[model samples]
Target chain A: MVRQERALRTREALIESAATVFDRDGFSVASLAAISSLAGVSNGALHFHFSNKAGVADAVEQAASERLERLVAAHGEAVGSALQMLVDTSHRLARRLGEDVVLRAGFELSRDHVRQGGRDLYRQWHAWVEEALKRAEGEGALNGIAPEQVASSVVAATTGFEVLGARDPKWLSRRTVTRFWQLLLPQLATPPVLGSLVAAGGPPGDHARRTPGGSPAARAGEEDD
Target chain B: MVRQERALRTREALIESAATVFDRDGFSVASLAAISSLAGVSNGALHFHFSNKAGVADAVEQAASERLERLVAAHGEAVGSALQMLVDTSHRLARRLGEDVVLRAGFELSRDHVRQGGRDLYRQWHAWVEEALKRAEGEGALNGIAPEQVASSVVAATTGFEVLGARDPKWLSRRTVTRFWQLLLPQLATPPVLGSLVAAGGPPGDHARRTPGGSPAARAGEEDD
Candidate 1:
């Protein structure tokens, strides 16, 4: 059991290494050597954990997804309302991923999974978004559109926005989310009564102690972008 | 003068080569040798045109930007309503780039450019969106919200939906475009003035018979994703 646990730890290390390399530089630039270097493992040991780069990528996706699932549950449970929970959770989740290059690397894994004909993890997330939209509808929180269409659009919009956020921190942060709430709030049946729409600090913070715009990692620690 | 013209042709060849290479294998994986070979030019000649890989990328960005500028004007002039024009043009543009890896590569380039610097090339497009919203508001076509906020939200939502279309062809189609119109129509300035919105087919295909989707060079013609 001890040996197996150690082996598992080593595997996790390699994945983190791979994710960092992939996220900082795109997949093509991410080399096995760099991955192993980041993990502080011998190249041979890295290979021992994963036979190929694709295997490493798969592990990264699963790990990131697991973390996201845990975050959703934890934050969801803590909040007073589901809608508030989602907004706060999105803020927190984006912060976490923005801070850690490995988590951001998960996006690449997602793209690769589609190219490789693997299980669509994005579809799984889409289902979750749909389920949430359905609940919102039941609570009279949605516009006239069907939950199916709205949910799919939300999923796409959210992911697309995230990609845009990753690329254009200034335009997106300076305007994107603020604009998002404008259009979306009207669509919702009711705005969450709990929490102010504009929260200060930690992504929602000011430039004195925090900035809403910067590289993902830097902004992760500051105000909401 | 002949040498100058030859130089211009060589530059064009290099830019086209960069687009093709970037389209097939993505930006980073594409090698200079591959680009040079595609251009059917010697390595020295390729270097003469573009000082480095970055130079090639810069050239591509300029060319793509010019093309996009033409597109922005084309839609603005051909269609009277800015709001309807954006959607209609989006559908057509999606088709234009759907199969042409070159156009897609252009999208990829501008995204990266925005990431590296806060240049305002694309910002102009957002400004136009804002202008449309305010005009709609003045005409009493807007919901109860600030026009600037509403316009920003609409643009973000539209863009958010666009990312979906790029990843999954089925997300945006003639039927889907109609659906989008239906959803946004109510939000418009007096029911979108129905006569103003044009259908998928434009100008009756009298010029060069360019297919609705794919590059003009495609063999089998265009097909929806």
Candidate 2:
């Protein structure tokens, strides 16, 4: 049991190392040697865990997807209107993206044209956002706006934040995303529901703790894949 | 004059070739040899026209930027509401992105985080979009939604389309972009002006022709850039 635990730990270390290198130098240029060395593992061990660079990337993508799934699930469990949950969840996602390199690398790798057949983070997020908005629609919390339209815009904006944040960290800041909700919610909600939405921070019961700004390794909202 | 024209053509050819290779193999991995070979130019000829790969990429970006500038200018000259102009311009851009490899490559190259200080296509697009929406506000065509918020969402959606298009061409299709505007415009415009906007197709006078789907090299909106 101890040996099995150690093997799992080594694999986790290797994935973390791979995320670091892939995040810095995109998938096409990142080297396995760099990842193995950063993990303090031998090349033989790295090969044993991952057959190739694509395998490492697949692992990273899977881990990130799992993190996102957990985030969505947690937000769903929170008590509030679905719209508020979405607002608060958007804040958490933006903050988590700013803090976690593994998540960032997963998104970046999915965008890589060379990498094939891995977890498509963008599509997954799109479906989740659609589901959340649909739930809001079911609750009659939405204004006249169509759920699918709102879903598309939300996915585009959040995904754009991730893409832009890769170049400028400020795009991932809670302030930017909050401002997004602030501007969009009034238009999206009927007058009666407008007061119920929180744009600059999160829902009243939301326990989303902010990560320290500018620290990629902070991992405040982290979870295992 | 003939000699000068020939030199200009050769330089254009080199930039186009560089864009092709750089689009296929990213900026870091693309080699000058491949670019020259694709252009059918000798090594010395390629060097005479461009100092290095960065030089080639800069040329492509400048050309694409000029094309985008001209597009905005044309839309500005058209007779209609600024909101209509913005809608028509977006349609043109989505079509151009589908048809023009050089323009697409220019955008991809600008997104390369490793390549610093070149023209930031995303930022430039963001500013131009903000200006257009501000103009719409100046014309008093905007509804309750703030111009800045509309600008932010437009940039995010269009830029998201571009990034997503890199992986799937369907994202850049006129149908997809048109659907975006159709969904977004009602929320952005006052009731009186909403009727003036065109979403699925171009404005009455908009000459933004559609390229047959699945053809990357068909330059439907080609200008002298």
Best by TM-score: 2
Chain B of model 1: TM-score?
A: 0.71
lDDT of each: 0.56, 0.76
- Model 2 chain B: worst 10 consecutive residues (lDDT sum): B216-225
> What fraction of the real A-B contacts shows up in model 2?
0.28
lDDT of 1 by residue, A1-225 (tens): 999998899998898889878776667667899999988889999988899887887788778777767756664444334444444454554455556655567755565312362435456667766776676567555554566655554554456555656655533343444344434443343444312333221233312223343323321112232
Candidate 1: deviation at residue A27, Å? 1.1
Find the candidate with the highest DockQ and give its number. 2
lDDT of 2 by residue, A104-196 (tens): 898888888766846999999889888889888888888766787677668777878888888888787765676466556765776777765
Among all windows of 10 consecutive residues in model 1 chain A, the one with the lowest summed lDDT is A215-224
Q: Candidate 2, chain A: TM-score?
A: 0.90
Docking class of 2: acceptable
* DockQ, Cα level, model 2: 0.27
User: Could you report the Cα RMSD, in angstroms, for every candidate shown?
Assistant: 7.9, 7.2
The list of candidate 1 runs beyond 4 A from truth reads A1-3, A71-96, A112-121, A134-144, A170-175, A185-225, B1-10, B39-45, B77-80, B113-124, B131-144, B151-166, B175-225
